[model samples]
Target chain A: MDAAVTAAFDLRSWSAAHLDRVESALSRWVVAEAPAGLGDAMRYAVLDGGKRLRPLLVLAGAEAVGGNVQAALRAACAVELIHAYSLVHDDMPCMDNDVLRRGKPTVHVQFGQARALLAGDALQALAFELLAPDDEGIPAGVQARLVRLLARAAGHEGMAGGQAIDLASVGLALTEDQLRHMHRLKTGALLQGSVLMGAACGSADAQAQDALRRYGAAVGLAFQVVDDILDVIADSATLGKTAGKDAQQDKPTYVSLLGLDRSRAYAGELLAQALDALAASGLRDTRALDALARMVVDRDN
Target chain B: MDAAVTAAFDLRSWSAAHLDRVESALSRWVVAEAPAGLGDAMRYAVLDGGKRLRPLLVLAGAEAVGGNVQAALRAACAVELIHAYSLVHDDMPCMDNDVLRRGKPTVHVQFGQARALLAGDALQALAFELLAPDDEGIPAGVQARLVRLLARAAGHEGMAGGQAIDLASVGLALTEDQLRHMHRLKTGALLQGSVLMGAACGSADAQAQDALRRYGAAVGLAFQVVDDILDVIADSATLGKTAGKDAQQDKPTYVSLLGLDRSRAYAGELLAQALDALAASGLRDTRALDALARMVVDRDN
Candidate 1:
């Protein structure tokens, strides 16, 4: 097989293994059951099927810096847990009130909003716990940076801030800048953190970190734009979840502001920019990243 | 001064210094801006007045093990941040819906529910970031243990689970065992974690850790019992917040089940148990821990 083809297969296999490792670690860590009921709610929320994109970014970023992908797995898992928590809370009746996620009923829908809220809260706390360095993982400073990055991304200026803006912007005709601002905080923060943290875990230098960050930002925005496009174009059956909920709610979206074609075009442009940033970094191991970026835009769900 | 008295005074002084350090570190760290709006909300929630009990536990525990109080401050601050976040969310309109906390408006009332929720979420993430071993303070294993302990305490089986049970138990009379179970998850998890993490940070052995945990659980229950008693006896102004809200909400309390006098007596017994645990630990630095146990029952706010 060609090197590119081999690399593609390797990436898929590696990503799957990384995800499995994360799942196993979570199982080992969360044992003990008077709490059995609480565990059920959390498992329902986290085990719902999805692409697991954030963790892929962490592993790929780590690999790009010549670090062991396995070593970065806990941080990757931590990021995913944080993401899952956000989804559970966002689906609460008082928040976005989402009823379905990844083809299954949302946490709030399945477990009730109060439990869902607590599950999210606990998951968020658990994410930090996961990131606390173990004896065999990446170095302490790198671990600290990863924790800091994930925290900031998950925090107010990042996901939560984005959520606040989203809540506030409902029924309001947000400007393009306002819409972008919300996306950056909500989706972009963790997306960027995922890649940067992965790279930092691998001990990437300042220049490399900057390049990875730019790459992350571009792809993060691109990911959302693609999501907007899919929301408009894909059917619920194909998407494996309810589509057009955003429009039904009259929440502002990239497609709403830019139209379908423009949004798709914007996603492409961002992908190109992300790829260009990756290229400029002059790193040899970013092939996985490049493929991941392309896959992001091309994904239908 | 006698050794015990001197130690008690030292702990008081050290706690103040530790709090100051946490405040300064947090101020210094949140310099970046895209998330600026949420950042402000986060700072507002964290900076508000509270007892600072969890952080003090971390500092005292570390000091007990002969660790530098300053080194443990970041971890201490992180736990406090998580606690603050929980309080913020617990008071939301969709949750407990309380209006007053520490004699001031709750975060949701002051900043709006959406902002408060985001702030709480962000703060939780920030807490982990604070603990992730950076810049010559604590070791990675200690940091890891801290993160794991705090996470487990905050998650489904701990504080969040406790909240779930509390919500479920409303309007329904619960047995004392059930009530104790609820308190253990809701309040004791974090309390036990606070002392354990502090001792671990100071490099306490497993035996010491277990003893501290026992001390923590006793004091933790005592703390809640005292709060319940005060709710009946203390005025809103003296309490620095509303005192009758719990009864008004008809939430389960030791006082409701056991009456005020029994609750007070139970609290005293718990305090004695905590002091006894401290003595059993055989540490040279039991003075601070002893004072803390006494303070838990006597505290008015």
Candidate 2:
């Protein structure tokens, strides 16, 4: 396709095909084997739900770099598993205590807390397991790089660390900078890691890597901004989660800090920044990445 | 040292030296960097406690194969971190609900459930992070191998799976095979993974690998059998945690399956099996492995 045609490419169809592939891969990977309840809870947590945005970012990142399809698929699934596991753990009574997610009962609510906890723990390990399979198709160097990136993003320095901050910040007012720092570790790190993991599947020049990193950061933050806005404006039915949870919990959010109108504008600005980074990447096939940035900024949920 | 001297080596001194190295490495790795409370909980969960048997197993296995010291140290700390994380989670109110561990207040009891949960999650990620560092000292192949081994041992097919089975089997009668299967996955897997991870740090022939696997499996099961015996015989203070928890929870155990005398006899048999595997390994410097087997079988706590 030419530039104009690629620019006008049907993202819905593209995403649909990718989502189907991811769903099938996830179903195959998340099995209900010997330990009956744990496997079932894991499958319940992972399969048949959500946007699969992290996986999409992974695939887009890989596509941008002309990366291997098989490796990219594995990376995509791995990131989604991490994201899913995080959600399972976060929804527990000790944390968010939410009863709903993805328009359905949360894992902790559907399967009791103990099973939910084990399911999350198992999913996290499964993510790394998928990334570093005993297959010769994936190079050892690639496996090591993927594991290192994912681990850091999911560990104390990243998502989990950010979560600790979120927990401590409950019912407390926070400055914009502190909120941004918290969001960067909490949600931004894994999203950035997804993009880098996709890049790791293929080779990228330093210039391209820098651009993708910037693009990932902007998109990651933009997603969160949009999320906070939706939490305020959209109902629980539309958002597929408990609406206005941040305000209810007295937790700080971008919408709370910048106001809804400004947060929406900020998301748009981040979208522009993400697109600019893509342009600077100097790669020819970043249509999916560009479309994804638009989707993140535009989505209601 | 000469063969006779090596055969008659003082195991206590040798273990003490290795324990010192493992403890120092763990202290260096388990840092309380960011997210304030999360790091504290992680440090609290990992530091200043436990027998460090898993780390010792890793060191001994590495030593048996002349593995790289740095790689072995990393593996040792990584395995212990995984173990510590499991303990933190297991002690949570949702699971075992114990108030004390290592003779101190459990993580959730001291830091609250949220911090404890995040700490456990972070520790798990930290374990993988330690295994696959962004360094050239450890080869990519070795990192991939170590990660794959550890993940499988800790995931659905291993420790987590065993825990699920344990949870479901509470208040239910289990056959000998069923009980063994549970222990194999729960405790045996990580123990065996430690041995395999150590072997991964060095070069081992196929025959040697088989022997080590047998040795690991035997020792792993032996450790659990002894644990069951100790749970019945030892008091709460002596065990450093709640004693008689298995029976209290109505959980099936080796002691319940094969009375005390038979359980003790089974542990002795397992120790002999482990030693025989070590002998079959044809590795000259297995003094440490032999002594460890004895310790596992003989230890009251």
The DockQ of each candidate is 0.52, 0.85
Query: Which regions of candidate 2 deviate over 4 angstroms?
Result: A1-7, B1-5
| lDDT accuracy of residue A247 in candidate 2 | 91
Residue-level error in angstroms, candidate 2, position A175: 0.5
User: How well does candidate 1 match the true structure in TM-score terms?
Assistant: 0.88
Model 1's CAPRI class is medium
Interface RMSD of 2: 0.9
Query: Alpha-carbon error at B148 in model 2, in Å?
Result: 0.3
Clashes within 3 Å, all models in order:
1, 0
The best candidate in terms of TM-score: 2
**Residue pairs whose backbone atoms clash in candidate 1:** A157-B35
